[model samples]
Target: MTMTVRDLRPDVRADAEGFSDTRRLALPYMLSTPESVVHTLTHAHPDAHFGQLIAEEEGEIVGTAQISVAHDSPEPGQGSANIYVRPDRTRRGAGSLLLRTAEERLAALGVRKLFAWVLDEPDNRAFAERRGFRASRSAYFLRLDLAAGMLPPRQDPPAGVELRTGADFADDPRPMFELDAVTSSDEPSDIAVEFTDYEAWLEETWQHPLLNLGLTSVAVVDGRPAAFSAAYTDGGTRYATAMTGTAREFRGRGLAKLAKNDSLHRARAAGYTEAFTGNDTGNGPMIAINKWFGYEVCATEVRYVRELG
Candidate 1:
């Protein structure tokens, strides 16, 4: 009958399950699993000071928070605490408790500026504003129904280009990582991040439970990875494009579109029913690519920032 906020215990299966359940219920557009939840918490960078919090109400986990510092960013003292509460369990004090605890923890770690993503709904926006957070940039969540076959027809790679899956580079994924780093840097984000540590990438990204390497398509130029479409599946009907980008030198060649189309076709063939992705509102190129593939905007979320002394 009382709601309490505490750290998530990955060792306890119920805790992981409940945390994942609450996340999926709160934000179905993104993929989340118990294994991914544990992996992220365990493998985060030391500088990140990552923490996962769960709000339990009489034995049910109804809210969750992902708290972490932007360690990879060139700047210091920037942190994030994204809190999500179950829609059916609204009006409870779970969000407030989680936010207070997360802010305190990050502040203790010397974080100065805090950011959070709030669903672009009246109640959610009010909650963030009430906490002294101001609305910032926004992103749109898009979805594609694979069963409908609305995806663009698969096309052959251009001359001297080869299409491959992320699994093809499993023996050595450094190439894929290199391509990812280059492309990720070009993405539109308030926090600038650099993927400089290969081992950390392997531990935190390449080994993530939801990443389906077999379905992640890559565009190779003369045997080098030039573009990629990263895929993450929920081990079920849902499939999502985590990131899709082309190297700077490979832009304007349509390499990203090639990789993503191949990946989506393969995913549909593999029986995935729903596909999801998100793009910042300012990212016109990526949004155009998603539209070309029949993806429609389903939901939106606005980033909110607050200063912490």
Candidate 2:
């Protein structure tokens, strides 16, 4: 059977569903939904020049490529193209075809630095190396058996602080946004990012299909959101933390730990069975927090970079 790479069409129902389905199975730790897929296709920053591509085999979608530029970063020509094939559908020509097509699109946009994330398996690493990419930093996927593990008991906030759900700020989420901006910039990563557009945040993150406002816990200090653990669910037993961070001024206060514990407790109480999150290897403090919650490292992936000539 011949494999071919092609653009993913948002208007086609089956194609969108297949793309989302493939991603969900290949990268279970990351939350992906049909609605969120469409939201990403339409609302992504214009400067990013994002492309959603799929690799098809004998009429079945087997792999996907999410290619985009790091438009908001201070550096120019920074591009990212992450490829994921369905676990049971490897060894086909899909991965190569997807990479080639993505590189061509990125080259046309004058991309100079191309980055990709490949699973830390031997074959995946070899594939990336053979294609002129070198490994950089790596991160682990942590999972907690919410249904069976004994989560640490939730703690009361110190004076001048309180625990609250993300839903509490339904009328005004700008405070949460401000906290997110501060935390995101400080996250350990290869590419530096800045999030200043409120409207973009509303379209991309706030309106995402899996963001569970009821379960996302936030720490409030002096009536201002200072730390938070964002939640995403597939309307089932699986729950994941999209992000957890503390504002710069409040780093030493332990508000992030408080929010994450509260969120995990809520998820387990709400009948969730599994909880997933990713942590960069260099982030000792965040890794320790996940360890405290009994999350074991299930998988790891390395970021590879290629400088386009």
Each candidate structure's TM-score, on Cα atoms with residue i matched to residue i, is 0.99, 0.98
- Candidates' lDDT values, in order? 0.94, 0.92
Error of 1 at 7 (Å): 0.5
Backbone clashes per model, in order?
0, 0
Provide C-alpha RMSD values for all models, in order: 0.7, 1.0
Model 2 has an lDDT value of 0.92
Model 1 segments beyond 4 Å from truth? none
Model 2 misplacement above 4 A: none
RMSD of 1: 0.7
Please provide the root mean square deviation of candidate 2 (C-alpha atoms, Å). 1.0
